[model samples]
Target chain A: MNDTSTAKTGLQSEAGAAMKQNRTAEGTVGEVYVDDPRMTCRNVDVYYGEKQAIFDVSLDVGKNQVISMIGPSGCGKSTFLRCLNRMNDTIDICRVTGQIKMDGQDIYDGGLDVVPLRASVGMVFQKPNPFPKSIYDNIAYGPRIHGLCDDKQHLDSIVEKSLQRAGLWEEVKDRLDQPGTGLSGGQQQRLCIARAIAVSPEVILMDEPCSALDPIATAKIEELIDELRENFTIAIVTHSMQQAARVSQRTAYFHLGKLIEVGETDQIFTSPRHKLTEDYITGRFG
Target chain B: MNNQQQHQKTMERVQQGLDRRYRKERHFRWLGLGAIILGLLFVSFLFITIISNGYTAFQQTYVKLDVFYDPEMIAPIGETDPEVLSRANYGGLIKASMRQMFPEVTNRREKKVLYGLISTGASYELRNAVMSNPALIGSKAEVWVVADDDVDMLIKGHIDLRLPESDRRIKDNQLGWIHLLQEQDRIEKRFNTTFFTAGDSREPELSGIKGAIAGSFFTLLICLTIAFPVGVAAAVYLEEFAPKNRWTDLIEVNINNLAAVPSIVFGLLGLAVFINFFGLPRSVPLVGGLVLALMTLPTIIIASRAALKSVPPSIREAALGIGASPMQTITHHVLPLALPGMLTGTIIGMAQALGETAPLLMIGMVAFIVDVPGSVMDPSAVLPVQIYLWADSPERAFVERTSAAIMVLLAFLISMNLLAVWLRKKFERRW
Candidate 1:
């Protein structure tokens, strides 16, 4: 036990030395901008009361493209995603500064109403959070709240279409009156996705949407994400490297409350510009 | 080999302690079972004592009398007018009938002892019969009248005949009269309708809890109406909308403390604020209900807040993420999820209100009200106050009545608690 303890300490010191060498650079690297951008965030900083959570971070989500954020836990990836639609306003101590704009309109403006912004920029959570209601009611809730359709018939068609777009129509069409919670984890996640889709949002933020799911369910979600990219701009926070690589066109890497790199998915994986991003992708340390 | 020996030694020590551990566990199990049995024994004892003591109050004794309604005695002017019928001396009719039954008793004191077998209220019964049917005047008819309370005690076997005549309320002469009536099947025990239908009376046989029950019903109705909505609103605002700060924290602490405050304080508050300042009528259900509502508000608010807090925050996030406003999210999702729990809390608070005696007594509900209250504004006495009054009375009959009133109050409390449990089970939802 003494020998192994000594050996572990030795390895930790060596890794610590390497980490100290890489800590000299403090800002993001690689391409952080895109042509034909849909939403732009510049120098975004988040603070929870006295503690700063996210440093100055700038990135762009392109039109009709999938952008995946990958980082270790508590790396502010989910925090940054919540900032896109001002969802952080619900937290009492959470304070965000810096500019985030969708279609050249500042979402953080005091005069801007958050309700419409949220409706347009929908969210899917880390866990499947279906309302304790019927499956049909779950999907129809978003549309009814937003008054997207004029009549019940229109709303029903919207629900059916959204479910079809989520690739869940066949499995759940006969049981729409049953509770959404009665479904399996994978199906419930799809129901949440369909609920998001029913509002016809222009942008969707998914915060580690596959973490609580089994691998088979995770694979199904990746497939759904690929198909969903045709109509909506999607930004996903994920821990799984394979999931980020498979579905996202662009990938951004975060480390210790700082954005380290952002680029094309293939370029970032093959030739990371920053030592931290390369070290993270190569599994040296998260 | 040395490590293996040490492991074997440890195993031996563990095996030795396992027996003692199992013995302790068995002892604990027996102790728990004994405690449960003891609790059940106490509960059953209470039930037996109450039921045994109170069940006889449900039946009353009646004496059969052959009444002769003579025209001269009833209407002195011989007109048989309605006023004359109502004001006539019906006691004379009862005495004449008793005289006809026992012709051998001629002395005035013996005749007075013979008349003592009937209740004073029996004259009113005869007058009502005469007024309802005036044709019965100047004719003899057999009627069943309520017997006196002493004769009732004797018939129910509560008054022991083996005791000396002075020790018991019923003397030998009265016992003989009762025996003679019993031999001819003129004494009977009937289900006590007056106990359910009539209001409180000085006569134990004429007293009933109908007034108290109506008073309780109206008080609880007013209490529920005032407490439920206001409590739920305060809970929702504090839980969902209010910012977390020192003020809200202080408010929360005060609410919890208010629940612990003695109930009579609220009655004093009602007495000062509602009766003295606002000048609402005293001893009315309205005042009692308002006082009870003040007492019940803290309990309901605390329970409702807890119910609201039990809803998972993720559901709130889901609703907000879908662009629902905070108010809309609460109305559409969170309130529906928490309603059953809130209802349960409200019912439990109501039960507490129903069983509350001190608060009502402080608010002047201890007044000896005899008339059944027709509305909320009418002066009245609630059930617990009635029980307190009856328990304090000197009459032997009021002792059983007190127990019977307690039984009724317990029945209502148990049913309300059962409803709370059923509501909880019916809507207990899982995410």
Candidate 2:
């Protein structure tokens, strides 16, 4: 472990040309503004202790639109997505310095409590975590904690509706009392998404939601995301370019902690602007 | 042909290697079994020796007697005066009655020996009988009296019966009388309620363990109440909220060191702090419990921290991701998953506290307490210190009583461990 820094030094000296190509973008490209955006972020920078992970990047998430962030590993796409819900605050060494406004209110304001903000912008992690509770409790926890229901029947209907929207109701309806961990991996991830939506969150942040699923399960979740966009704004980070093209209307491509380009998925895929963007899309080098 | 021969040789080598591995695995299994057997053998031997020595202490020998309370000899000033009745020589009355039973003994020393058959404390029985009903001052009544410790030991078969007359506590004449009494059904072995009801006494026949048991109970109650929540809270602060800095690291290191300190040192600490400075009463379970709690805090804190650490970080993330505050996340999710482990640690600490002696000894818990403690602050002799006090006495009867006290203590400690195991099994979660 102690030799890692020296090893990195040796690799960088030999691979100078590769290091130069991994540079920050001049600024955010493509249509950085959208009409009636739900969340507007500007000049965001993220740091981990002494190291910088994200540069100045700006973007707009339109209301009722599916925005998928596609990038290679360590490209800051996941870090940027976590900032939308202030999930980075959980990590002690991490620091986020940027203006991420939701509904024209500064989320980073000192007086604003992170509790209500997180409830409005719920999150789904990469690996499914279901609170070690029953499947029914997994879906009801969000609403119960927020006090969004009047009675037990109201809570039950909310759980059912959320599960139905996430396409996991039929598979788990008969055994709602069973532990959420007993479900298959695909079903577990869908349950987590349903758990996020139970509070009726206006926006849903999914961090590599289907990265651990089979192609069939991934197709099912992509369909769910498409249908979810009719009500809630959705932001997802993914590695698969085709998944972004299939599910999201706006495609944000991140490279070296910078938003290199973001536009209509069809436009970015068919006709890329930057040389690095075209090379990355054409499988030259990640 | 050469290639085929080479292939056969290689296969034979592989088979030999596999056989050697199987033999090694079998040898390792035998080693573990041998270790377990050794542990079980030692533990069983301890129980056997203790039960064989102490089980008889629960039953004592008694002698039935019929005494006539002559009013003129008992109360020369008349029974109407309660003060004069209180000073009546009940001991002389019992001895005179004993003399009547064995009229053949003419030697003055032998008569003294004859009178010594009944317990010294038995005189109190007659006094209580007459004092409660003054009308019985001149009446004849049959009553059961406690036998002396020497006779009790002889009846329990603990004394060497074949020893020379000069070396034994009971002479041939006394043994002959015991036999005659046994034949006439005057000697009876009765359930020893005194062993459970009375407190520490110089006479083995009159001593009991109720005072020490109560002391141990009060001390343990205070010890658990003070140590558990404080230990857990300290652990939670260090594990969850406290920033990783030099001060916290130093505190952690000191806690580890404190668990290794000798228990007697804690007693000295209590002596200086609780007794001398704080002016709390000496020999009370309250002060002893505070000392014991101080000694056990490090153990509980270390265990609780480990329990909290065993929970996966993913659970914390899930709670925070779903909008629960940090405090809410810990209370609702992390603490529940960590509870079984924490309880297991607490029980272990309590067991250690239960068996503690040197610290209480230094804190003056070795005093002869005669009454069951009514409150935590009452002076009492805890079980281990009582055992220590009994073990030091130069009496053959006390030897058995010491073993009996140990058995009771072991029973309590074993049940505590069993409770910890049961709770862990009942509440342990898979995730």
Candidate 3:
């Protein structure tokens, strides 16, 4: 036990030294644009106790663009997505460090309010989570909490418009009081989309939103995402290379806590890039 | 080749015939079903028997008698002193009524026995009437008063007068008078509203459960006022805020252990803490309710945690991802979703508390209270304790009353459980 503890401490110190060296060596490879980045992650590292999950990850999410993070299982893509919205804070042992900002403001600042931040950056989970409430209430939850609705008529209009934006208004407009969970899997996902949209967020983060869905439902969500990007900057984490290729403007490839490559999706797919990115896109070992 | 095939086919036929598998399976299934049906029937039989035997307890026989009050025996010389009225002898009224009913009973002891057929509560009733109107003391007035339990039983055909006089409280001669009264429409079984309106009494014939019911209501009121907020808050802290460390683990284990602890132990705890330490009055609904609340806390906590756990982690993720704070996510998303389940749990825990008597007994809730509790601090007994006390009494008449009390308690429990079911069905989220 003593030997293990000593060796563990030694390994941690060596890892810390390596991290410091890498940080100094990078010396700002990416350009710092004058316009505010919708999201900025700097030297972000996540650790589930001593097992480091994300290492010195830095990224800039521009406004009004769909950024897709693509990786195999256990490559820390989901972990990075979670860090964008501070969702990993829910885990007891998980710890994240370094600065993350939204609209040039440090989201992790002590004075920052998470409730409004969540309202500003809405999310659609991997699975369809339409609250066991009516479809109207599911869409109305965020708006109600933020006090966005002026009255019953205003809330009704918001619900209708959100559902319309999600491309589900025609199918469910007459049954707004029906439980959202009663819908088909595709409809449920769309209901969740409408729920998030009702909050009128500036950015939408989707974590494998189509993974649990059938092919038809996946296509519907993909179509919805395409339409959603016209108004909101979107960040999607997907394991499907085809999905990332279809929906994203830019793709970031992650492998074992490291960003192997990031570029325009068309360029990354069709042109030569990093060897690891090429290997992953061409059905090589993940 | 043909001969071998034929022999193999014959062997297969023999195997199928000799198996006996279908027969054995059918036998076991029938036997299992029979056992289940038998068990169900037995329970139903017990319920039917108890309900049938006790249903008559809800009705009582009353005798309408007109007794002339001699001014000499009551308000003499028109001296309308309230003290005289309070101290007026109602035994005289009872004696007068008995003499009018049984003119043949010349012996004083026999006449007193005959008058015993009248409820002891009649004296109190007569005194109350005379106090209200002193001028009517000299005039004959008709009054309705409850007949004794034995007389009621005899009217209901629950008693036979052929039994020896020594073996029965009412004699054959007294039963003849009861028959004559019944024939003349002077005695009749009527709905016993006093069973619901009046408090419990030492007299078996006059006892009612109104006091115990009131005590139960007050106790539950206190339980709800204290337990709901406290239990929900404790559950929220343990489930959402508390870190998963050794201290939290210890608390979790202790909570589970407390839930499994015998309810009587909580009774003892209440006796020591509420009665002895805090010096709350014994048998007060407040103390009983507090003790029951403590006993019910573990149930509420365990159930509330389960309800909280049923809320998917994704909802929390969705809330937090949008930048909602930890408190906001729980209060807005998680708690609202879990409310129906929490309410169902709370009702179930209260139902459990309602039926609990051991802890209340330890806190002296079994005290024979004759007046309905007007406040939480008033000394009182709950329905279960009343039933338990009545069941333990030596009087055979109390046996039926005990069963009647049980039926009421069972009805209350059934309705509460049904409400739980209805609530679950009404608000259950399919997520």
Which candidate gets the maximum DockQ versus the true structure?
A: 1
Candidate achieving higher TM-score, 2 or 3: 2
lDDT of 3 by residue, B1-431 (tens): 99999999999998897669778888999999999999999989989988987898888889988787767677784657889987878878878877876788899788777888888888888888888888877888888888888888777777666778888867777877877887878997789887777778877778988998999999998998888889999999999999999999999999989988999999999899888998989999999889888888888998899999999887777666655567878988899888878888899999998999888888899888899999999989899999999988876667778888888888998899899889989977666
Tens digits of per-residue lDDT, candidate 3, A132-235, equal 77888888878887899999999999999999999999999899999888999889988988888898999889999999999998999999999998899999
Residues A1-286, model 2: lDDT tens digits: 3444564455344334333233333455577778989999988989988777787788999999999898779889999999998988878889989799999998988888999999999898888888899999988887888888999999999999999999999999999999998998889999999999888888999999888899998899999999999989999998888888899999998877778777888988998765556777888877
Please identify which of the two predictions, 2 or 3, would achieve the higher DockQ against the true structure.
2
lDDT of 2 at B186: 87
lDDT of 2 by residue, B304-341 (tens): 99999998887887787778888988998889999899
Better of 1 and 3 by TM-score: 1
Task: Please give the CA lDDT of all the candidate structures.
Answer: 0.90, 0.88, 0.83
Name every residue pair that clashes in candidate 1. Answer: none
Return the TM-score for candidate 1, rounded to 2 decimals.
0.93
Query: Count of backbone clashes for each model?
Result: 0, 0, 4
Best candidate according to lDDT: 1
For all candidates, state DockQ relative to the true structure. Answer: 0.72, 0.61, 0.48
Clashing pairs in 3: A114-B323, A117-B322, A118-B322, A118-B323
Q: Looking at the true structure's interface, with contacts defined as alpha carbon pairs within 8 Å between chains A and B, what fraction does model 2 recover?
A: 0.63
Task: Give the lDDT of residue B152 in candidate 1.
Answer: 80
Candidate 3: list runs displaced more than 4 Å. Answer: A1-37, A103-113, A134-137, A147-179, A182-184, A197-200, A214-217, A272-276, A284-286, B1-35, B69-87, B127-144, B157-163, B182-185
